[model samples]
Target chain A: MGIEPGRLQFSWISSAESTKFVEVVTQVTNAIRALGPNPDFTKKLAEVA
Target chain B: MLSYAEKIREIAGRLLASGAVNMVIGFRQGTIPMMNEPHFAKNPAEAAKLVWDSHCGINLANYLTDRKEKIGIVAKGCDSRNIVTHIIENKIKREQLVVIGVPCQGMVDKRKIALKCPGEITAVIETETQVTATGNGFSQSFDKKDVLQHNCSLCIHRNPVIHDELVAAPVEEQKGIDRYADVRAVEAMSPEQRWKYFEDLLSPCVRCYACRNACPLCYCPTCFVDESRPQWVGKGQDPSDVRTFHFLRAYHCAGRCTDCGSCERSCPVGINMRVFTKKLEKDCLDLFGWEAGLSLDVRPPLDVYRPSDPNDFIK
Candidate 1:
């Protein structure tokens, strides 16, 4: 319940605003990257290797 | 509280005798103290079995979903709210229900009383302002205010929002109560600390779906937890799975929960899961100026979209 807001983002972009959509995507990715990995609610998948 | 039972029985009997409704849904005295069972009265004879007391904490609206018969339901404040939600959602038609509204004081927290008593409680007696618990070796009386269910104590709506008949004059509603103090306390904590607090709070969960079953809002035919084709969550009691289940369920109730405390009351392990829903309730009030199910004419905030709606979270 305490997950950072950046982890889930919602945006509205028209087809005409492709550049704005790209810019917003970059902003969201960077915000999530800064928070790093969440320690809770993430399943530890088995390694393929 | 004692006279309420007599009045409820009288109203239910009249409804049944008049053929106003096919069934009258109310509470009957439970075998054990502090537990009341939902009773369905089809005839006047069965209506006579109906009772009302502090232990009638379960919401009567939970039984009304998609029901086709004309039902006369005993509704307290929270139950009436849920019934309103049900009508708005098209789960049932408003014409099919005859709501007999009850002016509720509050329901007692049995778990709280159980903790205070030294022995098993054999009987519980309630008056206008006091509750007495008698048992094998202990007899204790408590001020009703001290033992009220946490949600009930902070409840703002003690009178039904809508009804066809009144059991008694509407009780004065609670006012100027800080309903979201606990939610604010959780918000004040750091993310890690908040996570730890919830993890500890939910650790005792055993994956039982009692909370979902008790909720009037959770009328989904196939809840996320039960969907196997996509498998939204695991069936076992894994910590992460448990968190996902609780969080997702809380999300499902976002704009619709009445804080009736049925989920907490039905929990076998006594987990206060209202922590999750109450936060969303506060947010709905703060962001959308919405308190759920107070009106039949207005739609819920999340159910409709407007250009002026808040979009600060969106990039």
Candidate 2:
């Protein structure tokens, strides 16, 4: 629940709005990059003994 | 509060006697003090067993989901709101319901009252403004205001929002109450701190799903936690799974949770899950100017699209 707001983004884009789609994609990617690797929700793989 | 029980019984009896409703859902005295269980009265005789008190905290609307017969339910403010939600959600039709509304003062918190007495509570007596709990050798009286459920204390909707008949005159609603102070406090915390806070809050969770069971909104035939084909959450006591369960459960009620406190009241470990739902409620209020279950004429904000709706969170 404490996940950053930018982790998930929602936008409505028409098929014709190619530029808007690109801009939103770039914004989302940047936001994810800024948050860095998410160690919280990811399940850890069991180590071989 | 006791007087309301007589009127409730009379109304339930009349409803059953007149054949206006096939069943009247209300509360009966539980085996223990301050714990009332939901009762279904199919005839006038059963209706006489219906009682009203400060402990009728379990939401009656939970039992109304997809019910077929005509039902006359005893509804307090939150219960009526949830009934409205049930109708809007198409879980039940409004035409099949005859809501008997109660002007709720507030339901007392049993946990709070229990904290005052050193021994087991054998009996609890309630007056209009005071609660007296008696045990083997001790009796303590608490001011009603001091022991009200957290949600009830902050409730502005003391009167039923919708009803076919009123049990008593609507009590004056609480005015100018700061309902979101705790939510706002959580929102002020940094992400890491908030995560730590929730981790501590949910650590005691045993995955019993009592909260989900008690919630009227959680009528999903197969909740995400139970789906094994593509399991959304693990069944064990993993912290992430617990968080996911709580988060997803809260998200499912985004614009629909009435803060009835049934989820909190039903929790065996007494985890206050209202903070999770209350945050979304505050968001709904702030972003969409909406409250859940207030009207039948209008749809919930999340269920409809309007150009005027806020989209600032979008890229």
Candidate 3:
């Protein structure tokens, strides 16, 4: 398997870096994954697709 | 002009002198004539090879995830937007990075420019910092517009989005145009026509996912399509299976894609991938009045929802 390419491999990768947006994105992506697509709602998508 | 080369060298020298960064990610001449490839330089000698010019068009920001240690990178407008998306998504930390901002009006669509300016030319120059290209030969100079890529005309930023150091005074701002004019035409169609168009595009998909890998926003640790434990998509080539992967990606990235043209550029099977992304980009702009990744302060639309979020089908 090819190596997993990181977001900025061509640049410095740092763990100590603090993101001003981390709290917001965590709240966001978690909210998204938590709300699994509604089966009934997706059923409509199924029809549309 | 061709000043990016010397500027990169000068910046690399300063970084080396200060021990500010240990490596520099920039472009080096490629084996192919007039082609460039990403390069990593650890020392001043190697850094001296860094180059940024018309041919240095590849976006280097995609390489930044999980990489530890301080390093500097060269980034253009679209590439910088991608960096912002990664930072906001927590995929890459924003610190420990030194972005060498290079003012790029636009880069030549190599293949197209080559087709236009066949054989050696005396000089090829950017006519406008980010809007025009002009090439000169023995006795003739023609507007670079003749060979500029479609993306260039619609480019809103000809300058880098983030940078520790500025290379060449930043170019004047360029107005963003509705580059997805063609996508709007498809949307103007009735919902039935829109579905038909999408189905047609999805049906031809081989599900190779060259589109996903090429996308700047697609930086997930594990793509949903690749999940086998719960099995989102079995490794099948059925038309229906292919459509599932395609639409899911578009829907996931509905309000997030910047339409940098990389997904379509990276597709090998000749799928018109742009149509779907552009349609979604336009819808995000129209419905939510939002575009993705430009501002780190604004959460991606899908990731944040208002209690009053509009849903026409909600009961």
Candidate 4:
């Protein structure tokens, strides 16, 4: 559903600690959100989020 | 000293008074002194009975997360570490807690301590400042540190991790080699010999699930063992099956097991569950350089993964 670990890291660590936490959570939550609500880990996460 | 006791009462009473939590879990003198079971005080009146000392070692925070109502808890060193993991895992919300952190010298291990006492045997009894065993119609008092649980023997984190109030100034953390260094002798055995070693140890297991039930981290509403639809382990007495249950459950607590020793302590069958849990405890520290539940910030290593994570087995 998402591009790559390197891409995730860039989006995540490219900023300060608070920004980093938000960046990573947003990226990962967004990636899982992209998979839609199907009850599999990715989809279920998105549905909840 | 009355004030110290009263201070404990005050923190618990105020937390109850403020509507800060729905229940406050602490230790109360059980029918027996040696038996420190987790206790709950749903109101200020019940909070008065909460007590402390080396005897108050049982981790009450283990009970907090599973309940739907918000609760505060009296946490000692080991208890707070377990609480830390519950927070990291999202098992309990941090805001709902009112931690009454108390310094711990160590907690008495009723079973181990009983053997060392003067009696051929009798019940362990306690008072506010001293603990005595009444056996053979006589009583003798011992210093609290003289007979403590195996974990507390090597415990360094003798202060609460997260506390709203402190009971006493924190004691300097103790340092000692792994008390379960005996497990290494078992590790030196040949595979076949090691197999026999575990075979000897776990053979007594009745599959009573006492260890699982006692574990703070064994939080699934339906555990893997209970999944009858696709059984992770069959309900059988076969040696391998017994081994699988012990091995998996011990590993399940890898970074998560704070060596609270609740598993082996609560087991009615007298299995040496410490051997397995301590091995996992040492391995997690050695391999990952990680300790579970020490802080709120770090995610548990197993539950949160990294692409660069190490594994010698992976090609």
Best by TM-score: 1
Fnat of all models, as shown: 0.64, 0.41, 0.00, 0.00
Q: Write the per-residue lDDT of candidate 4 for residues A1-49, one digit (tens) a residue.
A: 1112232333425345887787678877887677544321121122453
Error of 1 at B244 (Å): 0.8
lDDT of 3 by residue, B1-315 (tens): 577779888998789668898888889877764357889988888987887666665667667876787878877777777777778877767787888888776665655655555465434444344323234433233455554556665777777777788788887766646677788687577655665666676666677788787676777889998898998765776545566677678787787776666666556555767676777888788778887778878987777767666774432
Model 1 TM-score on a 0 to 1 scale: 0.95
lDDT of 3 at B149: 51
Tens digits of lDDT, candidate 2, B1-315: 679999999999999999999999999999999999999999999999999999999999999988999999999999999999999989999999999999999999999988878999999998989999999999999999999999999998989999999999999989999999999899899888898899999999999999999999999998899999999898888788999999999999999999999999999999999999999999999989999999999999987888786775442
Instruction: Give the residue spans of candidate 4 off by over 4 A.
Output: A1-49, B1-4, B66-68, B116-130, B305-308, B312-315
Candidate 1 per-residue lDDT over residues B1-315, each given as its tens digit? 578889889999999999999999999989999999999999999999999989999998999999999999999999999999999999999999999999999999999999999999999988889999999988999999999999999999989999999989989999999999999999999877888998899999998999999999999888999899999898887788999999999999999999999999999999999999999999999989999999999999997876778875442
Q: Candidate 4, after superposition: displacement of residue A14 in Å? A: 32
**How are the candidates ranked when ordered by lDDT, highest leading?**
2, 1, 4, 3
Q: Considering TM-score, which of the candidate structures 1 and 3 is the better prediction for this target?
A: 1
Per-residue C-alpha lDDT of model 4 across residues B241-313, encoded as one tens digit per residue? 6777888898788888887777877888768787887777777787777876788888777766666668744
State the lDDT at B58 in candidate 4: 56
The alpha-carbon RMSD over the true interface for every model, in angstroms, is 1.1, 1.1, 13.9, 17.4
DockQ winner between candidates 2 and 4: 2
TM-score of chain A of each: 0.73, 0.82, 0.34, 0.41
- Candidate 1, B-chain TM: 0.98
